[model samples]
Target: MTKQTEELKQQPGLILQPGPSGWWDSERVSSPCVLRCADGKWRMWYYGGDPHFDREINLPTGRCGLAISDDGVHWERVKGPLTMGAVFEPHSDPNRFDAAHVGVSDVTYNNGLYWLWYFGGDSSFTQVGNMRAKGLRMQPGCAVSADGWHWLRLEGPYRGALLPVGESGEFDELFCGFPKVVRDRDGSWKLYYHTLHPEKGFLVGLAVSEDGLHWEKAGQVLGPGSAERFDERGVGTRHVLPIGNQYVMFYEGVNNSGYHCIGIATSTDGEQWEKQDGDATGGSVFAHASSGSGRWDARAVGTPCVVPQSDGSWYMYYIGANEGGSDELTSQHQIGLAVSKGTDYGQWKRWGE
Candidate 1:
C-alpha cells in the first residue's frame, strides 16, 4: 500500500542566500531543478531575479542560474562554465514569445539526455491574459541538452510552448506556466503546471505529451481553497513524484492573508488529484517557521524541486522568503533544503538540521 504522507517538515540549517549586493542574483534565487547524476554529483538549475526589477516591472525578472554540489547540502554557483548571462536562452527579440523575461521551472534527464521546460513572460505586442489576470500569456518552452551543462533550444513551433493558455472561459484562461514534467511507466509524458483561474488566484493543471516536446492539455487537476482556507488565494509551482503507482504533488499555496506555505496532494492516474490537508491547519501540509525566529522562509515558501537521493532517500530544493509573503517579493528570497528518510516519502526533515 502507498503510504499516505502526513507531513513534510523544514529545518533551518539548509539555506542558500542571495548573491552579493552588486551581483546579478543579488535579490533572490528560486525555481530550483535538482538532478543527481550517476556519478553521485548533484547539479541544480534555478532562476534569479532582481527584487527591484521584479516589483518595478510587476513580473518575473527571472534569469536562469546554475549550481553544483558534491553532496546535496554544500553548494557553489557556476560562474565561468555556465556563461554567466543565461544557461538556456534569454529573451532578446521583442517579437518572440518570451520577449520580456524567462525562467525555467521544470527539467528532466533520461538516457543521457536532458529536457527542460521553461516559462516565458508576457508578450511584447499581444494581449494573452484572461479577464481576471493580466500578465504575460505565460507558456512553456522546450530545450534539449547532450550533457546537463550545455543546451540547445528549439526554434519556431518547437521553440513555442508545449501547451498554450486555454480558450475563453477555460480553467487556464489567464496564464499557464511552471511546468513539472515526468515520464510515466507507459513512456508517456505527464506535465503538471500552475495557472491563474478567473476566480481562483492560481490552480494546478495537467497536460500530456507523447514525445516530451509535443503536448496536449488534460484539464485542471487542483483548485484553490475555500474562502477561509490556507490556499484560498492560490496554489502554484507544483512538484510531482511518482511512487508505487500513486503520484504525490507538492505545491505552493497562498491564503487570503497572502501567507505562502507548502501543500501536498495525491493522484492515482496523475490526472485527478485530492488535496491532502491538515484537519487543524486547513490542509497546509508544510509551513514556514514562526516569523519570530527570523528565518529566511518565515514569510512564505514556493518553487519546490524534489529529487531522489541515492540510498533510497529524497531531497527537496525550494525557495524561501521572509517578506511580502506571496510569489512576487518586495524583499530577498533564498534557497532552502529538506530531507526525507528512505523509509517514507511522507515524512521529511530539514536537511542537516
Candidate 2:
C-alpha cells in the first residue's frame, strides 16, 4: 500500500534527484530520455546543470549525463569521461548550432545501434523587452553511438542541425527546439519538434525524413489547448510511442498561470493528433502534486518519458519543480516517476502509490 502524508498527497515515484558533487547536475537534473532494453537494464540520458553554469539562458541546461538502473526505480549515476562527468556536451566551435548548450530528447536503439536526437542553441543573445536571453535560436541535431558513450556527429545543413527555423511570417520563425523522432512502419521517419509563437504560445511542428538525416518540414500538427485548459498556455517536450495499431503522445502542457503538467493525445497516422480529456486537472492525465503538498513537484511537472512494461503497466519518467522555483525558467528542476493504474493510461499514480 501507498503511504499518505498528512492531507498532502505524496509523489512516491520520486526516485532520482540532483547529483551532490556540485559538478554538472548539482543544481538541477531534467529531460529524462530513458531506454529499457530486452535484458531489463535501464539507461537514462538526461540534461542538467550547476549553479554557475549558463547564467544567461535562464533555463537549467548545459550538459547531459547518464544513469543506470536495474529495476528502473533506483538509479546510479555513471562517471562520464566528459567535463564534470557529463556524457555529452556542446560543440566546441562557436559557429556550431549546439555551441552553447545541448539536451537529449530521444534515444532509440535500432539494429544494434543507438540514435540520439537532441536540440541545441547558439550563443546569440536576444533582448526581449527587459530581459536578455541567450541561445534562443535552438535547432535539432543528431548523433550516433555504438557503446552509448562515444558519439559521432551526423552533421546537418544548419551547422550540425537536422532542421532550421521557419522563414519569415511562419509559425516556427522564432526557434525550433526539443526534437523527438519516431520511425514509422514503412521504414520512414517522423521528426517532431516545437517552437514558441509570440501570439499562439507554443506549437509542435513535424518533419519527415527518409534516411533520418535529411528532413522535410510537414508544418504544425499540435498546439495549445482550449481556453482555461491545462495546456492553454502551450506545449513543451513530448514523446510519441507506437502502441498496438495506434500512436500515443505524452506531452507537456502549460496552463495560463504558467503551471506545467503532462497531457495525453492520440493519433492514428502519427501526424494528426487529438487531445484526450485528462483527469481532474483539466486536460492532464498526470498533474503536479498539490501546491501546498510541499512535495518536490508542487509547482510544475513536464517533459514526460513514458515506457511500457511487460505486465501492461507503464512508467512515466518526468521532470518536476518545487514551489521555491520561479516561473518555469529559474526553477530547481528534478526527475521523478509516475505509473499508470494497470493499463489505464488516463489514470496514474506516483510510484509506490
Candidate 3:
C-alpha cells in the first residue's frame, strides 16, 4: 500500500455529524466559517435556513448563525441569529446601493477587530421576471466588530463583479458568494470566492486588496476544465490554509459523472496550483458520501472550510447532502466537519485515515 493508504488505516474513524441537541439538524447549513476566538474558544459561522419546497420563492432567505466549540469537535450553536437584512456600508451612497437581503460568509481578524466579507442582493427575485435582471451583481462587501458579537457595516463592493463576459454583461451577473479572505506573507490581502458564469458553470476566482477596502481581480485561480481530464465540469467555494511556504486549497469539484466530490490542490506562490495525486485527488482525500448509513450527507459533500490549530491538528468544515442527486438548487444539505492528523496541509489524511 501507499504512504497515504497507510496513514488512513492508522487513524481513528472521525465522522461528520450534526451538533448536540439538533443544533443544525432542523436547518440547512452551508458556507461554514471556523475561527479560534481571542477568548480561547472555537467559533463557527454558517448560513442557515429551511429548504424551500415551494417553487414560488426564488431563493431561501439564508440567515447567519453562530456556534461555539471548546474542543473543536463537539459544538453548540449560540442562541439566536447574528446578522440580518441589507447591511449598509460606512460611507457609501445608501440610497443607490443599500437595497438587498444581505448575508455574511467568512470572518477574519485584523488589527484587534473582526472583519466579515459577505454577499448581498435581490437578484433571485429580479432574475425570475426579466433576463435583464442579469445586471444584478452579487459582489463582496465588508463589516467590522470590536467584539465578535455586535457588528457594523464598514465597506461595500471593495471589488466589482467578477470578470464581465462582455463589456455589456455584468462580471458576476449570475452570483458570487462564499468568500474566504486571508492576509498573505507579503502583507497583501487575498480573497477567494465562487463566481457563476452563464455558460462556463460555477468556479472559484481570486482578487487582491492593498488596504482591505479596494480590490482587483488577479485572474481565474481555479477554473472549469483547465485541467480538462480532472475538473472538467466546474469547481466551487474553497477554504484555503497556508502550510509552511505553500497554500492548500480544499475545494469542491463536479465531474462529467455529475457527482460532487472534494479535492485538494497546492500552490507554491498562492497563484498557480498543482492537483495532488492519489489521496489528494478524489477517492482517498475526497469522500463522495457521508460516514453514516442513512444520514443526510450520504449523497455528496462540498464547501470545505478548514482551520489549523496550534495542537498540530486540522479541522475541516464542509457541506453535506443526503439527496442522491447533484443539483445545487436542492435543499437536503447541512454543514459538517472532518479532522486531519497534522498541521502540514500536504499531509491531509481524511478522518479515520
Candidate 4:
C-alpha cells in the first residue's frame, strides 16, 4: 500500500451529519473528539443515539454533545449535553458501575481537568447477542470535567469503572470499549483500549496512569490479525499520535468481512507495536470506501479522532458507516473528515472524496 497508502483511499468527506428533528442527533452520530481551544475556539465532543431504539428520543442511553466551530467545517450545537438528560438513566444507587448504561468513550484534557472515558452497559444491547446472551456487561469508565461542559463521576455518580474487568475467562473478561490516551515524557499515562478477546477478536489493550485517576493493567498492546488480515476480525477504536518520539496508533480494523478499516501502528515505548505493510492485506493504513459505493459513508470506517491545525496541518475526525439495512451498526455511526499537509501529516485524504 505505498503510492502513499494508495493515495490514501476512500478519501472520507461528510464532515458531521445526523440530526434534524428534535435534535440529539435525530438518529445517529458516533464517537468523535476534536479540540483546539485555548480561546482559538473549535471544540467538539460527540455521540448521538436513538438509532431507532426510539424511547421517545431524548433519553435512550447515548448523549455527549457540545459543538462549536469557527471553521472545523461548520458546527454549532451547544444546546446542552454532558448527559444532563440521562439516557441509560438508572444509577439511582443500585450499587453502581455506571448503574445501568453510559457510553462516552474518549475525551481527555489531563492534569488541568476534563477527562472522560466510558463504556458501561448493564444490558439492553437491543439484538445481536444481547451483550453476550444476557449475562450482560460492558464496563470501562472514568469521568471528570471542570469546564468541558459539566461532568463528574470520578468515583461517585454511578462510580465510574476506572479500569479493571477481566476475570472469569479474561482477556478483558467480557467487554471493554474504545479509549486511547497518551501522556508520557515522565508524567506517566498511556492507555489504549478495546478488549473482549476471549478468542482473538476485538483486541487492543494496555493501561497505565499516574494521576489521571488510577489505572494499571499494561497487558496487550494491540491484537487481532492474520486470520486473513485487514485486522483479522476486530481491533478496537483508537487514536493516539505523538509523532516525534514515536507512538502513532490510529486504529479500528476488523476485517474477515465484518468491514471497518483504518489502521496504522508504531510505538517506541508505548509498549511495542508495528503494523505498516502493503497491499493485498498487509497492515492497512486506511480502508473502507470501495469507492464509497452508495454514499453516506460507503460501508464502514473506524472511530479515529486527530486534530492539530493551528496551521501545522492535520485533522482527521472519523466515524462513518452505511449498510443501514441491518439497522446500521456501531451506534449508528456518521461523522467524517480527513486532511493532511506539510510532511504528509500521516497521509490521510478523505475530506473531499
Candidate 5:
C-alpha cells in the first residue's frame, strides 16, 4: 500500500446507535448536526424514530434528540422534555409546513444562542408512482434555543417555511430539504439545500438571506456527476466549510447501484464548484467498505458533518448502512466517525484506524 493509504485506518464500528429501549429514537437514528462550543463541550443534534412512529413516511426522521461528549468520541444521551425525550419535534399546528415530521440539519451557536436549521414535511401526502407517500412534501424551518433544550420556532411564509418549494418545472420543484447555512463575512447568510428530481436525480441549490430569516432562492449550485462516476446518481446532504481563501464542500454521492459515498468539491465563490479527485475510484474521497464485508457502513454512507479539530485534523460524523435490506433507503442506519489523515482533507481513515 502507498504511504498515504498506510497512514489511514479502517473504521471500527458505529459510535452511536439507536436510543435506549422505549426512547423516541429506539428504532433508527441518522442525520447528525454536531458542534464544539466555546466551552469545549461537544453537542450533537440528530433525528430518529421509535416502534410506534408513523410508517407512512419513507424516511427515518420523526423526532430529534441531543447527545453530549467531552472527548468527541464517547457520547451520553440527554433526556429531553418532549414525548419520549426529544429535544425538538414537528410543529403541532396542522397548517404549519412541518406538522408531520422533522429532521435537524444544521445547528450554529452565535451570540450566546443556538440557531437550528431543520427540514420537515407536512401531513399531506403525494402520489409517486404507485405509492402514496405521507409527509413527503418537505420544507425548511428555523428555531432558536437559549439552553439547547427548550426551543421557540420562528415562523415564516408559506405555512411556516423559510422558503417554499419551487414553481412548476423548477429544479427544486419537488421540495427543498436539508438546509445547511453558512454566514458570510459581510454579514449575509447562505443556505444550501437539496432536492431530488425524477429526471435530474439529486441536485443542490442555494438561497441567500440578508438577516438569516428572509431568503431568496439563488438557483442550482451543484448536481449529479458524469456518467459512471461515484456521484453519478447525484449529490445529496452536504456540509460547507470556509477554508482560507476557498470554500470546501463535503457532500454525499449516490451511485447508480444506490450505494452512497463521500466526495469533495471546492469553490472560490461558494456558488460554482469543481470536483476534486480522491484516493478512491470515480473521484470519491471516501467510499463504503467492500461489499459483503459485514461492516456497519458497507452498503452506503451519507449525510456528512465535518468538524476541524484542534490538532489540525478533521472529524467526519456520518450515517452508515448495511445491505440487510433490498433497498438502501429501507436499510437500518447508524452514525459512525472518520478522521482525515493529518490535515489532508482528501485522505481519510475510519475512527479506530
Candidate 6:
C-alpha cells in the first residue's frame, strides 16, 4: 500500500499548515510541544478546544495551547489556556488534571527547566449521559517552566493509577495517559505512555525516572499482542526522538484503518523496541497528503511530533484530516507536516498541498 509519485520531488521538506481556519476551524491541535526558545524563538505546546468545546462539546476537552514561532514554520496562537487551572475536583489544580481531557504532550528541556509531560483526563465524568464521554482515563501530568509562559503544576502522580479492570485485565481499568518524556545521553529519564487495558485496547507503556518524579514501569511498550500481530485496535507513543544514537518512536496505530496511521519504531537502549517502520499487519510508517488524486489523507494521520533541525533536517509534527469520517466521532482532525531527509528513518515527505 505504497504507491504515489507524481513527481514533485524536493525530498528535504517542510509542510506545516493549519492557521487560517482550516484545521477544523482552528480547534483541534493534538499532542505537540516543540520548544527551542532562548531568544531564537520557536515554541509550541498544543492541545486546543474552546467554543464551549468547539461549538458545544463535540468532545475532546484537551486544553493546553500556546504557539509562537520565529522560523519553526509560521505559528501564532497565544491567547490563553496553556495548562490553566480546573480539571477534575481537588486534583489540586497546578494547571489542573485535564479538566476532562488533555491527552498527549511530551516537550522537554530538562535541568534548566521546561519539561511538560501530559495525559490528563476526565471524560465528563465518564460520559455520564453517554455520547459526550467517549474514552480516555489518562493520568501522568506535570508542568514546569522557566519562561515557557508561567507554568507550575509539578508534584506526584507523574503516572499512577489506572491498572484496575481486574488488576490489569489487559488494560482499561480507567487510567493512564499519553505522557512521553525522553532524555538519555547520560541524563537518564525515559517515559513513553498511553494506557487502557480492560482487555488491552490501547497500549504502549514504559516508565523510568531518575529524578523526574520517581517512576518505574518498563512493561508493555507496544501492545495488542506484540509482534505476532494483532494491533488489536490500539497503540500509542506519540513522540520520542534521539536520531543519531537511535531512538525514534512516532506512534499512533489504531487498527482497521478507519483512520489513525503513522508508525515507526526503533530504540537502541531507550528500552528495546524494533519495528523500524510500521508492522503488525497494518503496514508501518505512514503519512499521506499528495491528494493529486483525492485520497491522500482523506482524514487521519495520527499524532507524531518530531523536531530536529539545526540544518540537518527532520520535522514531523503530525495530525491530519481536512474532512472527517474515520469514526471516533469525527470532527476533521488537523495539523500536518512531514519531512525527513537524513535521520534515515527512510526519507519521508509530505508537506504543503
Top lDDT model? 5
Compared to the true structure, candidate 2 yields what TM-score? 0.95
Error of 6 at 79 (Å): 32
Off by over 4 Å in 4: 1-20, 32-46, 49-103, 107-115, 118-179, 182-188, 191-208, 214-261, 266-268, 271-273, 278-286, 304-318, 321-353
- The stretch of ten residues in a row with the least summed lDDT in candidate 6 is 2-11
Worst 10 residues of 1 by lDDT: 1-10
lDDT of 4 at 47: 68
Which residue runs does candidate 6 get wrong by more than 4 Å? Answer: 1-33, 43-72, 75-107, 112-179, 182-190, 193-202, 212-232, 239-253, 261-296, 304-353
TM-score of each: 0.86, 0.95, 0.76, 0.31, 0.95, 0.29
Q: What is the C-alpha lDDT profile of model 4 across 1-353, one tens digit per residue?
A: 64423322443477666665666566777777887777777877776664444342222245567677888866766766423332223245545665554557577786688776766555343222333232135566766777777776667222456675677777777655566678787888877778756457788788888865678787777787776677888677888888877888878787766777777888888788987654423357656667437665566777888877766788888887775544343434677887765545556777765
- The pairs that clash in candidate 4 are 1-278, 1-279, 11-350, 12-350, 61-87
- Between prediction 4 and prediction 6, the one with superior TM-score is 4
For candidate 5, the C-alpha RMSD (Å) to the true structure equals 4.6
> On TM-score, who's better, 1 or 3?
1
lDDT of 3: 0.59
**Which of candidates 3 and 5 reaches a greater lDDT?**
5
- Writing each residue's lDDT as its tens digit, candidate 1 over 232-320 gives 88789989989777998888888876677777888898888888765324567567767667766777777888787557877778887
The predicted structure with the larger lDDT, 1 or 5, is 5
lDDT of 6 by residue, 1-353 (tens): 21212221232222332233423224444555677677899887766553334232343434665678887765666654322322212133334345555543777776788876766654334433343443344577676777666676665643233222213354434556667788777767787777655445777777787777777766776765354232446776578778777887878765544445677778888677875544323565664443332442544566678787777777777666544453433554545567775755445666642
Where in model 1 is the C-alpha error above 4 Å? Answer: 1-13, 51-55, 80-85, 123-135, 156-159, 278-281, 324-329
Rank by TM-score, highest first: 5, 2, 1, 3, 4, 6
For 1-353, candidate 3 gives per-residue lDDT tens digits of 95533532442322323233334223455667778887889877665443332233233224556677887755666664332321222223333222343446688998999887766543234442344442144556677777666667664533332222223354444566667787987788888877767667667878788877777777667766554333567777677778778888887877666556677788987789876653543432656554346644555667777887778777787776665443444545566667765654444444544
| Candidate 5 Cα misplacement greater than 4 A, ranges | 1-13, 327-329
lDDT of 5 by residue, 46-110 (tens): 99998788877888789999999998877788999998999999888898899989999999987
- Candidate 1 whole-model C-alpha lDDT, 0 to 1: 0.71
